[model samples]
Target chain A: MKKWKRSARLVDMTQQLLREPHRLIPLSDFAERYQAAKSSISEDLAIVHEVFQQEGSGFVETVSGAAGGVRYIPRAGWERSRETALRLCRELENPSRILPGGYLFLSDLLGDVSLVREIGLIWASFFHDREVDAVVTVETKGIPLAYATASYLGVPVVIIRRDSRITEGSVVTINTVSGSSKRLGSLSLSRRSLQEGARVLVIDDFMKAGGTVRGMIDLMSEFRAEVVGVGVMAETLTEERLVEESASLATVTDIDVKQNRIAVQLGSLFR
Target chain B: MKKWKRSARLVDMTQQLLREPHRLIPLSDFAERYQAAKSSISEDLAIVHEVFQQEGSGFVETVSGAAGGVRYIPRAGWERSRETALRLCRELENPSRILPGGYLFLSDLLGDVSLVREIGLIWASFFHDREVDAVVTVETKGIPLAYATASYLGVPVVIIRRDSRITEGSVVTINTVSGSSKRLGSLSLSRRSLQEGARVLVIDDFMKAGGTVRGMIDLMSEFRAEVVGVGVMAETLTEERLVEESASLATVTDIDVKQNRIAVQLGSLFR
Candidate 1:
């Protein structure tokens, strides 16, 4: 084994930690890999830790125990997250985005990799302390955001399909209503997508009156899974909220279809 | 400004590169951030570059000129990719995964973040030289894989919905057949999801005779977009493949319903 310098160790350690988020990597393993002392490895981690905190990239959590070591927790600072939400609000406020029935044409943002990742990092920060066994979301628009967040959290994503397919084996289907259109819809999930008694974090691209979010929460009960937290990239702001206790990066204050105007406000995160 | 040591600089650089893949990052930016000389930053990048290459993590390319800078290309080495595929093959060989009509129950692997990301990195490496403006995939299972690949490639994802919705505005719908079951199916893509003359890379979770892949390619033509390449996680072994010049990680050779056996083989990457 080669005795790596501090510079080389820092570079390798950062990559390792980022690749395996929420995983506890022992200092002894790093020491052995680089042929450095545990104390020296700790020093290298400290420098990486400081830069992560200062830059609002994430956190380096150190645990002192026989089986414990250092773990990387993906998160962004409060101000950084707020700025990300604000920038999104500006783009979503486009007049052309107003569609029928108060819906916004922001499909582009749901597919945007960088924007989804920014929201994912921010969402991860909020649930860094909670034990999230898996990330769950409905299919189509929300899959990208769910995958992005799951990647940062180093967890699997369970997508709720709109229709059941024979290829999915046995599935649990639930009937729910679309919040925006007030029409009934169905969501199905394969039995194997999640484990029994799993702690799930529900993520969706949009929350229009929270009907879809409520559907997801209700569906989790069928698997005996608990919905620990719910996060959405953007949600509608109104008095008639279907489900409460949710976080969003941006809020759709109003959408005037005939006037072709849409107002997007920074979400509850700013408050 | 406080000058950063070699260890601190390495950590910051790794994080910055990881955050913005395929984007050019000048050494001067790093030098200014750490208040270090350009020469020192170059030396640090060289060390980071060597580690990334050796570990099969990614690539660090350096260009020389007024606008030249280092760009990180997300990829995994051939050996690593092959190993990932082989491991997946072994697990997929389970007889229980066999479904009716030759379909395998692989929704689980499609949702696994680590697995999807590992395959996504490999797929991105295959088309890194191509001018990919966006990733295209059909709705449901392929969404996660498309998003993962798009994240690494730094491109947006355009999901083709099974059914058209008014919320998506004007959409282009195409009729296709299920490759295995020979049943008619419809796929629709929003007119605004992709721009005309754009180059697209198509990704999917499973492929059988490539009917769905063919549908996506035909739909892309409706948008005047070119399909640069196609990559699937697993493909069925049939001499009558509808689309050629594609890549896959694993191949299902045989699935015996009565015998309760499945034969999984390494895909084109091995060949």
Candidate 2:
């Protein structure tokens, strides 16, 4: 095998580490690939780690001993997380987003891939130490955010369907009622979607009194899975809350259809 | 600003380029960030580009002019694409995946983030040159694949709902009938989700006779959006095909639920 120059190796190594976040790659494997010594590889990793720390993007964690290797854990620093929350607040303040029934038009924001990815990074960083086995969310609006967070955390995303389909095989279904509107609904998850006793992080686009999220938590129990964390892109200020604890990126203080006004603030993630 | 060593600069630059796949970044911006000269930045880019090309991961295109900059275009090499498809085929062949009425249990596969991402990369590389303004997919199963492809292409995703929700505001809906089963359905897209005359790439998880994809193409016309391309993770062999042009990663030739047997082949993408 041909040896690689330090410059080329550094570029390739960064790409590999970033591509598979949270996956440990043995140093010997890298040493073999680059035809370089293990010490040289360690030096290269130190440089990458320092740059990542300086940039606040993420850090490369090193493990020692025979089964040791390095893994990239993605993170959004305090400055970046605050900036994202402020931007989301500004976007939510748009009067045109108020609908006929005071519902905010969020399809545009959810569809913005870059913005969704940024929000996902924040959640992944917030829950990085939870040892989450998977990211879970209900269908429709929450799918993108769930997938984004899962991608960054290097985990699979299991979506809960509003109505179970034939293609899902067997599923665990649960009943739910909207906390704010008192509407009835059901959430379903395929039996094979998650393993028993797996640790999961629940993610959603919007939360109002946490009815849907509460339902998700109940359903997770049916499979014997543990709920490690719950995060939402945005939440409304409601007097009655079903979920005891959760994190959100932005808060909707008020929405007035007749006045065409909406009030927004940074969410609990910043706090 | 302090000057950055070449090794550190290469690692950071790679991370930035890979994070935003198609966004062009000016050389001057790199120079300013690294406290280096434009010529040195150019040299660094060349090194990154060479490693990417050698690995068959992607290439960096440098646009030279007053407004010109460099952009990274991600691609999946033939060997890697083939490997992904074969692995998918093997996973699909398991008899446990067969459900009643011959419907395969695909929820597990769809929930696998790494597998879904690889499929997305294959589709993104296949349709990278189409100038896709957005990725469009129906709700539920297709959302993950659509989001993954959009993330790689650096484009937003517009989801077509089975039933229009009030939260969507004004929507354009169309009726659809399953080509294989002849089941009646409807597809809806938010009026503000897509712009008029925008180019879109359609992605889906499964296609038996392309009814869902066909409906999406028709619905895109309602907004005067052009369907630049259509791609699916898997498509079953059928005599009556509704779509004229499409790409797929894997093909199911036959399925015998009673006998618990499924015949699979490489999809049209390889051909």
Specify the highest-lDDT model's number.
2
- Which whole-number lDDT from 0 to 100 does residue A13 have in model 1? 95
lDDT (10s digit) by residue, model 2, range B214-243: 999999999999999999989999999999
For model 1, the stretches where C-alpha displacement exceeds 4 angstroms are none
Residues forming the 10-long window of minimal summed lDDT in candidate 2 chain A: A96-105
lDDT of 2 at A196: 98
For model 1 the TM-score comes to: 0.97
lDDT per residue, candidate 2, A1-271, as tens digits?
A: 9999999999999999988889999999999999999999999999999988888888999998899999999998899889989999999999988876778889889888889988989999999999999999999999999988998899998999999999998989999998888899999998989999999999999999999999999999999999999999999998999998899999999887777889999998877
After superposing candidate 2 on the true structure, give the runs of residues whose Cα lies further than 4 Å from its correct spot.
Answer: none
Docking class of 2: high
**Clashing pairs in model 2?**
none
- Summed over model 2, clashes come to 0
